[model samples]
Target: MASRKPQTPARKSWWRTGSAWKRIALWTLIAGVGVGLIAMVALLTAVYSTRSSLPSYDELKSSPNGQMVRVHAADSTVLVSLGPSYGEWIKYDQIPQVMKDAIIAVEDRRFESHWGVDPLGLARAVRTGIANRGTGRRLQGASTITQQVARTIFLSNKYDFGRKMREAVLALAMERKFSKDQILELYLNKVYFGGGAYGIDAASRKFFGHPASSLSLAEAAVIAGLVKAPSHYSPTADAEAAVSRASVVLGVMAETGKISQATAAATDPRTVKLAPEPRQNSVRYFTDWALPQLETLIDETEAPLEVWTTLDLGMQRAADEAIRKNAPGDAQGALVSLDRDGAVRAMVGGKDYVASIYNRATQAVRQPGSAFKLFVYLSALEAGHKVDDIVVDEPVTINGWSPRNNSGRNSGQITIRTAFTYSINTIAAKLGQEVGFGTVADMARRFGITTPINTQPAMVLGTSNVRLIDMTRAFASVGQKGVAVTPYGITRVTANGNVIYQHEVDTSHVLVAPYVAAQMTDLLQTAVATGTGRAAQIGRPVAGKTGTTSSNKDGWFIGFSSGLTTGVWMGRDDAKVVPGLQGGTAPARAFAAFMTKAVAKRPVEQFETQVTLPEWQLEPEDNAYYTAPDNGMFVDADGNPLSEERQPRSDDSEEGAQGDEQLDQDWIDRMTGNRPPAPQPDPGRAPPPRDAARQPPQDRAPPRENPEGF
Candidate 1:
């Protein structure tokens, strides 16, 4: 009886009632609507924030996606084609119909009909993403051709919600302003195809060795496939992968009715032929060095430009070959050659540019060693000291440092010219002290050494670091008759057939007096003629200095010849010492090799005659008083004379007397036009009393530690 009463009144569950279910459905609908409103507000906020930073439509329309820049050598040889390699702009109608079809078929099927943002394409992309989740398949992108144009022109390929919103907004704006054909043209021209190529024309040329206008269906399909993944589908990178992708592109084209299935089947992807990869030449180093100068010379414009450089291709090739042939196997070499007007004619940054792009000629800064002595002697001459002025080459202390010669022995008293020719460290140190280290540093700066110079006693021995280009420019000043020279590479820049920039030659700023330059030139000539830099002699009137750092970590030969100034440097990038590596060896020989070819066509020119100075005399009691030998003979530390047969022929000579006899004969021959017999001394006046000044100084302090002996 109780069960029957309960059954009669048993009510339906609340959730099962119609009113309860209706309430639940109503709340669910409200929640979904609120979320949609929130998303709409967030999207609007993102669009509003992105609109302000967008570039103007006019700017986008006027500017080409890729602009070409060409650099030409002095001989009009193309040195490099910078930016986009295609200098000619391709118009929309000029693009092949097959190319357009291939791109549209694979990239956006509804490109002709859909707006910038395709709703059907977006829904399909979302469905694809949902299906591809955790399936290890790439999700499809729904960006229409117009949207791609908008993104490529005004936005980066950053995958984020905000960027998408901005891209959508820009796409709508672009759709309103530009025709579909115009958008398609921009996308075709602006898209990158890897291998330093941009645009369809460049890609076609780079991959097929032909223009886009001549592309075949197979080629078009291949290029269209590259738009998805340039590096992966590049014919140059992977021929098989590129062909496979092209086959897929052809299938898509056939399915989309852009091409007949029979035509797609007849076209063989394997028939695609790729052009040979371009060889990377060492001349790229020079172009790389000169490229940055463009920004400084001209305004930032998207127009194609032609840069006429001062580079002499012949000389550049010679320099590259010289560096390759002369640089040590374990070391790298760099050479920079400049005309008297400071035009950079040839520059080799390293033995192989492909191995390393760090430009040693223009970028590397290393100790110049005795090559830096050019500045020191120039300073001495500027300070009222003549080339023939007496300077003690004996051991001396400066600021607790004693400087010694490369031979670890002193030549005692010697003329400034003779000391400089021999690169006597003690004499250089003494002169630095007398004239002031600050003065020496200032002289280097005046001569175009832009790097910071440390005003220290050791700096007199070339302990300061310097760039090869700067050092070459300094010596160029001397070759320019004391006029300051600023090294320049670009001669002129033109755009749209209009000259935009031209280099002006300025020789009004004088770094040193003409007489001082002449005197310094004489010293440098002596150095290359019979001293440490003798290895650099190219059977021409070349003048330069040899530099060998303390540990032989760096070797340098900077000189001028036949209206050309060149600097050669050899060393390891890590500054590791190279055994038997000296400035007079590899670097000097490289200079000779380079100059022999660099100046082959130039007329032989003579340097300005040296300025003669009054004969210097010293008091008999002065410890620095001494005389040079009549026969050009030099004595060793033990007072033993070196015989002609025993004298070193290379720069390893202890007293830098390798070619002294030859130099003496040359001077005599030049003066009289004939070699004369050596004048016999009057028994040398009792042998000049054994040169008492050569004796070890008993009144001086003990020798201090000498670093970086010259």
Candidate 2:
């Protein structure tokens, strides 16, 4: 073969020829083009399949995401936003150029050059992600601004190859449908900037307390940096991280020629002023308590809602500060304040909401102790008992259980006013028996105490658990002049610009007769004025009661003044005793601290004057010496008997002994008909020399027997 025709120059094998190599390259290119065409066809087909499910462009323009539910205080202060909060949509012309430049530098420097997706960036991201796999490095994201717009408006946040293909397709389609500026405006308005804020406008106002048009270069950089990881770079959540990220943004801005290097270096990220955050997160407690009420007030809708609540932001701040300052280190405290009309003004569910979210003011059910005596005294007044009526505070047994005074020493004889003022448990127990436990429970229910009230003997001493809100509502009823109150938070709710709901006060329901309320007010006023609740006084008329459960596991002070009713409770969540804790101590002091500031702007209001009643007189034969069947003796020269035959005194003798001087004389006059004038000494005759027999009786020794209970 080698000898034949000199091998034809070995045929110059086509494989090694230059022209053959060029032909081979051409074929390789053609095959690669064919493969790319098939891939593009598959991608188009997949994108077309998802197109039908994508939201229409107009739909995306309407609302890219669900609207927020904004809760506002009574003064129009924005307290919280439940979802994505959006501000007024800003036009492209109104957007700050610096903001746009900063965002472009940090988010997408190639935004102007790319149609939608940056091919070079996509390739780099793929290579880096591949290299980073299994290297403990997070995979890089290659979403362009157009891609983010597509995702925010049309796609769910699911990570997969299918989503990526759909995103690319949508971005391409968006580029064809909208101009670059339109896409950027949409991006700036629809992107979430953390802190519940969405859009550049909301982010600007939220972080700088100004509109987007007012953003400075430094502030713009800070806001722009938030786009990558809103929560992680939130100026409020982490100021240092936010500033650091902002510095990176500034550097990139200079490098991209969007800003001068000198300008970038001159900008101080630390100097950017951020809006002041709430003093404490405890406002979340009020928001939590009010959110459920929102659900009940209106039908569910995706439309943005504005809930104007009755909360007083100033009072809320005061209440929060009071709780934090007064709540013992080892214990927690809660407070609920309401207007006389039953609108919630402020609520502190716990000293620290971050530590626990259980709303003790509305959720906890603990013994009210003497605080429950409010219903007992009100029931007595409704049953025709005078506040000045004498009732022996001696230990008394009811159904084999004896209830004693909180002092653990029985006061020999005191008016109902004195007994209530001192929080005498024995007197409360006696009144409970006299009025019938069923009547006491009914009275509690009538005054907005929704919690179940037991009719057992111990229940007379507040052994039953009750919520602070219910108790505050009950006291508000008294402050409302007997009108039954239902505590409400949201005063009005509006959606888009239409009023969806508005709270209406119903004063037609009466919890007690006006005169009965006046009588109860009189008793409560005395309690705070000079008795156990004295610590709750704020130099104005206050009517409240103090309660301390056995072992001091719970302490409470519930009071009302100047149309504001507040209840304070302190205790451990587990109901363990707090050493030295009592209603008269920290709880009452907290009440004073809160009410002092809460009522500072309000005019002083006096409780309704008590109605006059016939002087309570004891019948020597029927009431002077009554003995219980269980050997419990009660002796009172001026006590009224619990008998059907006993009748109001027909004669105005004014023969009953005078009450303590510490008692209000005007109140005593209202209870008793009128006191007779003292005998005048003869003008010329020396007053009879003071004699031991004529001297006032010495203070009676405290009863020897120590009571077994409060």
Candidate 3:
């Protein structure tokens, strides 16, 4: 009882233990930890499930030979390959161990490793790279065999970390679905070696003139080295680099124990014994030009499809060779070949496709200069003017639009044939005026131009940009007796031996009557026989025109023979002047080179032969004026110069015209910063961007003169 009394008295003390508070905190912490554990478990479950459930390899269906492209000559030969298809796909067992080992050793050392990835190899590469730079700033790759295969099958060729993660997932999945041997074989077969070859077998034969089974160790190494950067390490682009890269591959293989050190060290990269003559085969320009025409035929997003085109590989090669032989150092060229039916037989966009992706034959819309005169003359023919009609090639102005002749001075009176043959701009402009700009644009559109065409008279003079394909097609219409056909690349496309798509000559509309086209043809014949396009002489008749745009931004030579139609273009990508050149210079020379070689083994033919000359000249007027904006002015603003009477003045007064345009001026002044300050072309000549149309004709400079001796 005394002890209980003492305990009660102790409770009355002010100092007290905080055990209850401590117990409460302990229970709360335990409950919070249990809830946190549950949340963590849920989050981790979601993460792992999502990660582990990534698309597996079993879901991926290998594209069954995505439409094989058999690039051919007029005759049959495997000129090139451009599809996931195959003529023959050999397994690793079929390949010589040397070649197989070289490829595996160079591409992926641990080919037989965990899943599809080579984690240890990757780690080693990253570690070594970091050690060298003492930082992770180096651009290095850590893709394993599976990753490489996955990327080729599922991704574009751009390097990034997202792509890396996707690659890992896909690689793991791929390993789960395909056997190691199958993955290795597919990867080897899918790799691209330059020269348009797509696999080891194709490359081996193309480069070494032998199969994969027969390649030597050095040759194998060379092919292996190309895996990293095919075009860059190509034997054609840089033989020394190819050899050097090969040495690196061989050394790597030895270091990784895939090949003996002695074998790698003794490998004679220099004595690799390449083919006697380097493979000069390339239809890059031609194929590039052809690719665009295919899009017009089908939906581009559909599975890769074969484009069985009419392109003759031989002609393509010859054209490339000619361009190389005759092209200027800074200049590039394009060539096109079509049949009478409008099937584009061969096309070359530029000398090298890998050097530039610009498809000069299709993507480049150049001013056809004199070549554009073809349409002008065609319009003249359609307007009931015969090839024998005569027109004056004299300097004249009409309706505020005046164009100069390419020859600098007019050649007095000339026959229509003579005017075209000589590329007399003044006469061509006269014909354009007669036909009307609307007529000319209509005619051009009918022939296949998908470009804006000004209704101004100058539109008749090739001011509208046109692609080489459309240009050639228009000229071919004349060759085809006026039927405008859509240019087609693929003649037949088959899948599983079943035709999926086929292209026949599709004549859109009658561009010009046969008689009119024929008449135009008769006139252009004179062009090849004597006009500015005479350089295309293939020891045969070729009727076409020479086009050189203002300031020499573009040069063109388009012509057609009885069997083939071809056009050539030369210019810079930005449409800037290439000083000291013309349509008949680089372009024509290349045309002649390609034509000479192309027609070498073919038969000779002419343009449905005919003779036409100026039968009679038109009568001269009191004040000879040209009409039509593109054709230069044929009459004054009142249309009276060539008519019965001329207007006296009121409306033509500058002040009256300015007053009438006062509203326009006000709006323009407001839209611009303020009121127009006394017009100035020089503020240091920064006279604000101008509306050339609003200015008086005299304010504009005369058209540029054609270069001498084109």
Separately for all candidates shown, the number of backbone clashes (residues 3 or more apart, or on different chains) is 0, 0, 22
Expressed as tens digits, the lDDT of each residue in 184-224 for candidate 2 is 99899998898778899999999899999888999999999
> Which of candidates 1 and 2 reaches a greater TM-score?
1
Name the regions of candidate 1 deviating beyond 4 angstroms.
Answer: 1-63, 85-195, 199-277, 610-664, 667-710
Order candidates by lDDT, high to low.
Answer: 2, 1, 3
Which residue pairs in candidate 2 collide?
none
Model 2 segments beyond 4 Å from truth?
1-65, 85-280, 406-409, 610-699, 702-710
Give the per-residue lDDT digits (tens) of candidate 3, residues 375-458: 677777877887756566567664666665432455554456655665555666677777786787887777777877666656
Deviation in Å, model 1, residue 261 alpha carbon: 42
For candidate 3, give the lDDT of residue 385.
Answer: 86
Candidate 1 residue lDDT tens string, 74-172: 988897887755434578899999999999999999998976789999999999999889986654678888888877676666567887877788776
Runs off by more than 4 Å, candidate 3? 1-74, 83-281, 289-307, 406-412, 601-603, 606-609, 612-710
Quote the lDDT for 426 in model 3: 64
Candidate 2 global TM-score: 0.56
Candidate 1 total steric clashes: 0
TM-score of each: 0.61, 0.56, 0.52
Give all candidates' CA lDDT scores: 0.75, 0.75, 0.63
